[model samples]
Target: MTMKFPFQIIDLTHPISPDSPSWDLDCGFTHSNFIDYEDCTSEIKFRVQQIHSPLGIGTHMDAPAHCIPGAASITDLDLHRNYLLTQSVLINVSHQTDENYQITKQDILDFEARYGRLKKNVFVLFYTGWEKHWPNPEKYRNNLVFPSISAHVAQLLLERNIAGIGIDTLSPDTADSGYPVHQLLLQAGKYIIENVANAHSLPPIGAWTLTLPWKIINATESPVQLIGLVR
Candidate 1:
């Protein structure tokens, strides 16, 4: 049977490939043809490829175990409960902030003032306009000085009991910041999605996110395909 849906879907994931940008200085994605079409026999017409990628490469999710000891891994999250379909809020801070800006608690408060107080259990996505630089890894990474969420903002989100947070850049924390935001959120059992693409297309408050991760058991992170379903 064919199925039908009634929402406008927007892809929020970057294409993953060997050339995709990496959070780590030296690591990136790699893949190889494991079974080529040229080598296929009469009985086998399929070709297969093997991919090797850092868990943090491209658009991905960081499970609680990413920063917290003995916490839930990617596979540990229940698809239906944690990620399948979730409410979301977009907080855009592109206009007033620069490349090195740190998103503060006031940024969120301002968003709330404009959009109304955030409802609980919603995924908060930050559209920093950083996505425009995604095609240039040098600029996207920006010498590790890209915009990020301050620890203060992270704590404020935690207080609101959000399901998770997403950003259009490499991470919520700067590379040199020692991951204070990561530790705080992950320890509280919240997941994080980084390198989200096409966030500009989503509305500020009504879009719903559907996150599908490459589930790997006991792994700290997983590459994810995120989609926004909007009316």
Candidate 2:
């Protein structure tokens, strides 16, 4: 039936590494072409000879020409708003003595007073549970504060006109240099989904937030092999 809903596709990716932990505020990830084969001698055809990357590397999504100077990249937006069947909301505020965990405005008004006010286009997912430092570089990018989203909850999800917003870790902007919530959500044209892995495996509410990015045209950010179809 393919319309399940409950929760558990939390994979806010970020394991590309020169030594893992990236972001001095830009460019870092290098996984090279690893051609491997054992045996295939029949009606066989295969070729994926190691594709290296840097469309903003690893578990990505940030188009609107990545901060709106020219705007509308990431394959010129509108792949049905990049796979939206949303209504998934999780706000955990990841803790381990909270290493600079930003995300406030009373955590979006206490999660809309406990799950209510989030409509418009609905697809906000930020569980900040930073996946236990997946590959760790002093717990992801030399931590100071990388659990983000707090320019007043990115202007209160653009005053609830919400059509997009995703995060599990890596770049929601707790400031490393200057991302200002990716320049206030693509300059209010709104759209942002980044590094979302195993948002602690869902179930903070009903689930069905399938984000699918990669139509790579002008490519400012791409590679969103997402899934969260629980029931």
Candidate 3:
């Protein structure tokens, strides 16, 4: 059977490769070609590649278990909660030129003032215009400091009961080890999508997000293929 989608599908995931940047605690992506078409005879025409890397290396989503002990893992997350196809809004904060900027409650409020209030179960994404530096370890990971979701803003989203939050940067929080935003959001049963690509392409509202992650049992996080369905 064939399926039809009513909207334009925009890919939001970054390709994972050996050079993919990873958090300090995670190993970089690596792969090996186990089978080559050249090695195959007339009887066998196939090739296989083996991938090795941490689940968090590429564009990925973080489950509650990523930070909180005994929390929901990637597989344990509710389909409705973690991977919902729902309404979304893009709060563009690229104007914040300061490195290591914090996305404050005012930023969210300003967005709402111009676009109306954010509804419940809506997927909120912040486009920092940082994806332009992707795959460059020195610029993307080390030198380019991206904006982060502040704790207060996290609380505001929690109060609004947003389905999930996504960002164009490596994480929703700063490079700091203590991720208060992650902790608060995850603890509230909200998931986070990091390293989102092409966020700048999305509109402020009227977009839908479908986040697809590997159902890895007991895994704290999983690399995801995010799709933005635009009307």
Candidate of highest TM-score: 1
| C-alpha RMSD (angstroms) for model 2 | 16.7
RMSD vs true structure, all candidates: 1.8, 16.7, 2.4
Using TM-score as the yardstick, the better of models 2 and 3 is 3
How much is the lDDT of residue 87 in candidate 2? 66
lDDT per residue (tens digit) for residues 6-73 in model 2: 44455445546555444554445555645434343445644335555566555667877777778888
Error of 1 at 204 (Å): 0.7
The weakest ten consecutive residues by lDDT in model 2 span: 33-42
Please provide, for model 1 over 44-157, each residue's C-alpha lDDT reduced to its tens digit, 9 standing for 90 to 100.
Answer: 687888987788888999999998989999998887677557889999888955888899999999999999888888999999999898888877877888889999998999
Model 3, residue 135: distance off in Å is 3.7
lDDT of residue 74 for candidate 2: 68
TM-score quality measure for candidate 3: 0.92
Question: Scored by Cα lDDT, where does model 3 land?
Answer: 0.85
* lDDT (Cα atoms) of all candidates against the true structure: 0.88, 0.68, 0.85
Q: Write the per-residue lDDT of candidate 3 for residues 1-231, one digit (tens) a residue.
A: 999878988998898877776666334677888988997776868888898788887789999899989888888877675645788999998988876888899998998899999999999999888787775755777643567788999999988889989998889887663788999999988899999999888889999998889988999999998999998
What is the clash tally of candidate 2?
A: 10
